[model samples]
Structure formats: structure tokens, C-alpha cells
Target: MQLTDDRLIRADTDTVWRAILDPEVLKACIPGCENLTGSPEAGYEAVVAQKIGPVSARFAGVVSLSDLRPGEGLTLSGEGKGGAAGFAKGSAQVSFAAEGDATRLTYTVDANVGGKIAQLGSRLIDSFAKKLADQFFERFQAAVEGPGEAAEEELAEVDGDATAEKKGWFKRLVGG
Candidate 1:
């Protein structure tokens, strides 16, 4: 599968670049990521768990960044063997540019899978891949922008503070 998308991060180019290269930041951004260790120059090792359709796997892989251009961008490549579940490998070309006080990040990804997972057909696999990509990017954006940005935006669109709209835990549980 192939996918391309872009997001406007409400942070400076340099800050965004730093977050992209940070192992802790990357680990927090990737969904189901249990562990991520290593440096950009030497490549990183990762353990991620996920369930796609019916197949569940804990993938151990090596992720690497190449063609880096400081605060600009780089290519991210990785491959994971999921034992009998199958294997997945992919590469993403990522670019960054400053737009005013923010950074615009664009990524183009090409991914492939083989073995038992391939039997699931293209439609299911494609949708799962798209969801996974969206999840990673969304989480990354949130990490860079800091927590509560989305909640603040939502509150701004409403008439009152979001706290006033909240219900107690018991009320929500009983559909009160």
C-alpha cells in the first residue's frame, strides 16, 4: 500500500525536528509501541503490538532514518517479522517546512506485507494500513503540540468552558 499525507504542526521547525529524532517522543507517538531504543545514526529497535482484522502480532523490528537534512526531513524505513503471522516492511519519505510560526510535515509511505497476513486480501489490509498511519501521525502531532490542544480547541468552539459540560462518572455510566 501507498499513502501520502501532511499535517500542520503548531511548533517551530527546529522543535518539531528535535521531537522527530527523539526516541522517547517516537515511542510515545507510535500506537502499541512497547519499546523503542537506539540513536538516529545507528538505527532504532522497536517492539510494537497490534491486531489487524483477526491477526494479532507482537512485531520486533529495526527502524532507521536516512537522507537526513537537519530540520528539513528524512526517509524512515523499517521491517518487522511477526513469526507465523507474517512480516511487514515499509519506507516513508518525510519532509518538513516552516510555515509562519508552524511547521508543515508531509509524508509519503509505501508498505508491503507477506506470509499468512497476505491471505487477508487487499481491502482489509489497505484499511488497516491507513488506520495505522493516521494513528501514528495523529499521535505524533499531539506529542509535538503538547497535551490539551485538542480539548482547548473544542472548548473554544463551544459556548462555555468544557468543564461545565462534563458529567459525573456515575451520571455518564448510567446514561443520566
Candidate 2:
């Protein structure tokens, strides 16, 4: 599947660049991302749990950045195996630009799947992929700017240090 989209982030281009490079921000923004480790230079290892249709699986993958252009753009690519659920690999070419006082972030994605996931049909997979991409961008915007009403309610319902950790992560990025 191929998808292209963009959103205006309530942050400067530099700030958006920094947030894209931050592992914490990436971890928080990715839907169902249970754990993400490593740095931008060395690539990242991620574990994500997701339920698509009736298939639920835990995916382990490595994501890396390439084609660096400083504040302009870069490409993100990753592949994961979900045991019986099959495997997926994709790449996104992301671009960032300064628009007014905010940043306009755009991405074009190309993805492929095999194994049991391929049997799920292109319609289901395409819709799911679009939804996932939409969720990622929305959550990334919230992470860089501030939590929306739904995020606030979700944060309120979640107990303990998760919320605190998320807040601190954002603060650490913004504070410096």
C-alpha cells in the first residue's frame, strides 16, 4: 500500500526536526508501541502489539533513518515479523518545512505485507494502514504541541507514572 499525507504542527521546523529525532517522542507517538530503544544514529529496536481485524500479534522490528538533509527531510524504513501473523516492511519519505510560525510535516509511505497478513485482503490492510498512519501523525502532533481533549481524558484514566513519564518526556524535550 502507498499513502501520502501531511499535517501542520504547532512548532518550529527545528523543533519538529528535533522531535522526529527523539526516541521518546517516537515511542510515545507510535500506536501500540510497547517499547522502543536505541538512538537515531544507530537505528531503533521496537516492540509493538497490534490487533488488525481478528489477528493480534506482537511485532519486533528495527527502524532506521537515512538520506539525511538536516532540517529538510529524511527517509524512515523498518521491517517486523509477527510470528504467525506474518511480516511487514515499509518506508516513509518525510519532509519538513517552515510554514508561518508552525511546521508542515509531510510523508509518503510505501508498505508491503506477507504471510497470514497478506491473506487479509488489500481493502482491510489498506484501511488499517491509513488509520495507523493517521493515528501516528495525530499523536505526534499532540506530543509536540499538547495533549488534545481525548488524550487528556486518556491520560487521566491511566494510573501511576505512565502519565508522569510522558509529561516528563515532553518537558525534557521542550525544556532544553
Question: Which candidate tops lDDT?
Answer: 2
Cα RMSD of predicted structure 2: 4.9
Writing each residue's lDDT as its tens digit, candidate 1 over 1-176 gives: 99999999877788778878878777887778899999999999999898878999988999999999999999988889888999988888999999998899999988898888889999998888888888888887777764455676575568466544432222233343
Give each prediction's root-mean-square deviation over alpha carbons. 8.1, 4.9
TM-score of each: 0.85, 0.85
Model-by-model lDDT, in order? 0.82, 0.84
Clashes of 2: 0
Kindly give the stretch of ten consecutive residues in candidate 1 with the minimal lDDT sum. Answer: 167-176
On a 0 to 1 TM-score scale, where does candidate 1 land against the true structure? Answer: 0.85
Candidate 1 overall lDDT versus native = 0.82
Which ranges in model 2 have alpha carbons more than 4 Å from their true place?
148-172
What is the lDDT for 109 in model 1?
86
Scored by TM-score, the top model is 2
lDDT of 2 at 150: 66
